[model samples]
Target: MRFVRYGAVGQEQPAVLDADGELRDLSGVVPDLAGGVLADLPRINPQSLPRVPGNPRIGPPVGRVGKLVCIGLNYSDHAAELGVDPPDDPVVFLKATSAIGGPNDPVIMPRGAQKVDWEVELGIVIGQRAKYVTEAQAPRQVAGYTIVNDVSERALQLERSGQWTKGKSCDSFAPMGPWLVTPDEVGDVHALDLSVDVNDARMQSGNTDRMVFTVPAIVSYLSELMTLHPGDVIATGTPPGVGMGHRPPRFLKEGDEMVLKISGLGEQRVTVRAEG
Candidate 1:
């Protein structure tokens, strides 16, 4: 099933995509899609619910996200483009939950920011608690998948003297959703294609097959280091073609537009703007 949250930010109501691809109100069936609720999504006939009147705003599929964990350079080709070798272990980092925003929301550029970049990635939404789980047991802990635009500020990320989180945790930096596609709905997660475009120009195109770390591998590995709770989101790294990898290097600016898509998870079209 494809679950969603539709309405205004903070007022988003739970919804599910019906067979006809219409949004069916799930507010009467369940609460917001988050935490323990994700582990046991009710089995319902979407057609029986009220159809959403029109195209309301779609918020991040998962609510009250506990953590936005990310894996860096998980794609071998991405590591190659950056002139580095893939790490033996997943490169883990954390993006502040405050950065979470609706997929279509505007991305705000930080003051004095330079080298803002775009990374199209596949996001894994955790369903159940996991700790020291093996790869074989990891599948049961996953609820679904979503698209993530891991926006970054290279200056603060690589030039400044701090971790990547500083450049990554700015509000509106983590645009996710459109739908939270269940594993059963998104068969073969490793084969999904993902890409990103800036202002209608294709900038990044790659597949999950190129990932140095697979989905279950990432989940299992992360569980070993920290407890994975329901509603935690893991951004499996981006593919090659980031603005930073361009010949002359490209970066986002005010008024820019971004389009991100992953095979069955759905798409995100966002506008870029300067912060007040």
Candidate 2:
């Protein structure tokens, strides 16, 4: 099933996509797709729920996210573009939950920012607690998958002295979801294609099949280091062709528009704006 959260920010209502691809209100059944509730989303008849009227703002599918963990350089080609060798293990980082925003929300370029960039990634939403889980057990712990636009500030991320968090956790940096698609609906997660387009031209294009660390490997590895709770998200990492990897090193500017998509999960259309 493809689950979604729609309405205004902080006032979103739970919903599920029907066979006809219409949004059906699930608020009557579940409060929100967050915390422990994700572990046991009821399998009910979609037709029974009231149909949502017209179009509404679509918020990130998972709410009250405890942790927005991100894996850096999960793609070998991505690592190469950054002039770094692919790591033997996952390069973990964190994006503040405050960075979470709706799919179509505008990306606010932080004040004094000079290197805003885009990264299209696949995100995993944890459905249950996981600790020391093996690769085989990883699948069961995932609630679903979503698209994540891991926006970044390269100057703060690489040119500064601190960790990547400072550059990665800016407000409106992590735009997620149009849907949180259940595992059964995704068929093969590793084969999905991902892309990012700036304006109307394609800037990034890659596939999950090229990931240095697979979903199961990433989930299992992270579980060994920390407990994975429901509603916690893990952005597996982006593919090559980010603005930073361009010949002249392109970066986001105010009024720029970005369109990101991952196979099956859905798409995101966001505009860039300068912080007031």
Candidate 3:
């Protein structure tokens, strides 16, 4: 089932996408799609519901997010485009959980920053607690998957950064959701198509098939290093075609727009604005 949290930023209500792709208000029964609701998704009656009028705001399904993790250069082609060797293991980083925001909100740029870039990523949400789990047992630990922008300020990330978080953890940087698709519903997460578009111009286009590290491997590796708790989100990293991958190094400026999507997980379109 495609589960969603709709309404405004602080007031999003639980919602589920019906079989026909219409949004069904789940607010009547489930208050929100976090914690216990995520573990019991199978029992949801998506059909016996009312259609949501207009386009309700799509917030990240899991409210009150815990730790927000990210894997860098997980795509071989993305590594190639950047002219860097793909790391032997997943390159891990942490984005501020506070950076999380609604799926369609504007990406507010940081103060004194100009080199904003977009990365389309397949995000994994943990359902149960896991630590030191094997790859074979990893998929079973994941609750579901979602799309993430993994927005970055390239200059801050590479040139003047102590850590990538300086550019990665800005407010509104991580625009996620539209839906959190359960693992069973997504089939093989490895073969899906995904892309990112800036102001109607496509910037990143690729597939999960190109990922250097598969979902199970990423989860297993992460679990070994830290405990995976419920409501934790792991952004599986981006594909080739980031603005930084360009020869002239194209970067984002104010008033830009980004429409990013992944197959099966749905779409995320965001406007870009400078910080106040």
Candidate 4:
């Protein structure tokens, strides 16, 4: 089941698409898509609300995102492409909770920004509170998965020479979800194919089959460091072919369009514009 949050801020509704892909309101049944309510997703009949006419403004499925954890270079080829060595353990980082944004929304390039790059990743949303969860028990803790564009400002990230958070946590930096594809629908998160495109040209592409640290390993490792709360997200990391890996480093400019997709999940097209 693909669950979503839509409409204006105060009036937003928790919704789900039925078997025929028709939107049905879930707000009356479940309060919000956050806090991992889908863990024991209650059986609600589909005919409960008015039929949705068309696609509405899709917001990030999880409301009240706590902290966003990210893994860097989990993909082997991606590490090699950037001329960096794959670490023995997960390379972890954080994006400010304020960086969250809608998946198909415009990506505003920060002013005075030189290199705003794009990374396509498989994002994981934790459903249960997990601490010291073993690899064997990791799957039981995850709520579902979604397609994510880890849109970054390279200069803010690298040129500053501080934590990656500087460039990674710009407002509207985290664009997540057209749908949160449940775990059962996305078997083996480490083996999916993910890709990104700029305009009509293919830019970055690869399969998750080559991740240095598997999904379960990452979740287990992270849990040991900090409590993994429901509504918190983890970007499983991107495959090879990011603009940063290029010699000249192809980056985004105003008016550019981005299309990103993950298997079994949906796709989103984002247009780049100068931040107002």
Candidate 5:
């Protein structure tokens, strides 16, 4: 089932896509799509719910996000593109929850931002609390998967004195979710194809199979450091073709449009705009 949250910001209601691809209101059944509601997704029947009359605005599928964990350079090609050796372990980072935005929302370029870049990543949504779980146990704890555009400002990320969070945590940086697709519905998570395009030009194209550290591995690795809770999102990093890796470094500018897509999971379209 493809689960969603619809309506205006801060007032999004839980919903799901029915067999015919119409939105079905799930507010009567569950308060919202977060925490326990996500864990209990299998118990809900989307078709039994009333259909949403029209094309309501879709918001980020999950709410009250506890954490937005990220893996850096998880794809071998991405690491290679940056002229860095692939790490033996996952390169972890945290994207502030405030960065979360609707998949199709406008990406606000921070003031004086010089190198705003786009990364199309596979987001793993945790379903159950997991601490010290093995890779074998990771799948059971996964609620689903979604698309994440891990937007970054290269100058702040690499040239600044502190951590990557300074560049990664800007508002509207993480545009996520047209739908949260359950693991069962996604089948082999390792085989999905993902890509990114800027203004209709293909920028990045790679499959999850090229990931240096697989999904289960990333989940297990993160679980050892912190308890993975339901609704917590983990961006499993992007493949090659980020703006930073380009020879001339083609970063986002005002009016630039970005489209990101992952197989099984839906797509996200974001337009770039200067911060208001």
Candidate 6:
């Protein structure tokens, strides 16, 4: 089942996509797709839910995102592209929850920012609380997965940053979800393909198979460093082809558009806009 949330920004209602691809309202059944509600996903029958009257605006599938953890350079090619050695352990960082935005929303370029860039990452949504979880147990703690565009500002991140979070936590930076696909529905998480296109030109294309640290490994590694709670989102790093790694480098400007997709996780379309 593909879980979703639809409506205006703050008033999104829980919903699910039936096998026929029709939207079914889950608002009457679940309060929102977050925390314990994610754990109850298997118990709900999407087919039995009332059908949404027509196509509605889709919002970020999960709400009340507790923590947004990210892994840097998890892909071997991405590391190579940046002229950095792949880390033996995951390079972790935090993204402000305020950066969360609907998948197709406009991406705001910060004032005086010249290096705003894009990263297409696989987002892992935690279903249950976990601490010190073994790699074997990590998969069981996952609720599902979604696409994450890890939009960044290179000048803020690499040039003047105390921490990468400064470049990563801008409002509208993390555009997430078209649907939250359940773990069972996305068999073989590490074998999926992901790519990004800017203004119809393919900018990044790579497979999760190239990841230096696999999904389960990332989850387990993060568990040891911090307790992973329900509703916490972990962006498991991007494959090669980010703007920063391009020849002569390319950065986002007003009116630039980005389209990102991951197998089984749906797609996202984001248009760049100047911050007001």
Off by over 4 Å in 6: none
lDDT of 6 at 236: 90
Decoy 4 TM-score against native? 0.95
Compared with the true structure, all predictions reach lDDT values of 0.93, 0.95, 0.88, 0.85, 0.92, 0.92
**Which is superior by lDDT, 1 or 5?**
1
Ten contiguous residues minimizing lDDT sum, candidate 1: 27-36
Q: Can you write out model 3's per-residue Cα lDDT over 156-231, one digit (the tens) per residue? A: 8999949999889889989988789999899989999998878788888999999999999999999999999888
Report the C-alpha lDDT of model 4 over 87-192, residue by residue, as the tens digit: 9989899998887877888888888987999999999988899999999999988888988788889888988879999999888888988788788778877778
Model 3: runs farther than 4 Å from truth?
none
Q: Which tens-of-lDDT digit does each residue in 111-222 have in candidate 6?
A: 9999999999999999999999999999999999999999999999999949999999999999999899998899998899999999999999999999999888999999
Candidate 4 lDDT at 173 equals: 87
Q: Which regions of candidate 2 are displaced past 4 Å?
A: none
The all-Cα superposition gives candidate 4 an RMSD in Å to the true structure of 1.5
- Residue-pair clashes per candidate, as listed? 0, 0, 0, 0, 0, 0
3 or 6, greater by lDDT: 6
State the lDDT of candidate 2 residue by residue for 149-252, as single tens digits. 99999999999998999999999999999999999999999999999999999999999998999999999999999999999999999999999999999999
Q: Write the per-residue lDDT of candidate 5 for residues 124-155, one digit (tens) a residue.
A: 99999999999999888999999999999999
How close is every model to the real structure, measured as TM-score?
0.98, 0.98, 0.96, 0.95, 0.98, 0.98
Candidate 3: 10-residue stretch with minimal lDDT = 35-44
lDDT of 5 at 9: 88
> What TM-score does model 6 achieve against the real structure?
0.98
lDDT of 1 by residue, 1-276 (tens): 999998898888899999989999998988889888999987899989999997789899999999899999999999999999999989999999999999999999989887999999999999999999999999999999999899999999999897999999998999999899999989999999998989899999999999999999999999999999999999999999999999999999999999999998888999988888
Q: In candidate 4, residue 25 scores what lDDT?
A: 83
For all predictions, the C-alpha RMSD in Å is: 0.8, 0.8, 1.3, 1.5, 1.0, 1.0
User: Candidate 6 clashing pairs?
Assistant: none
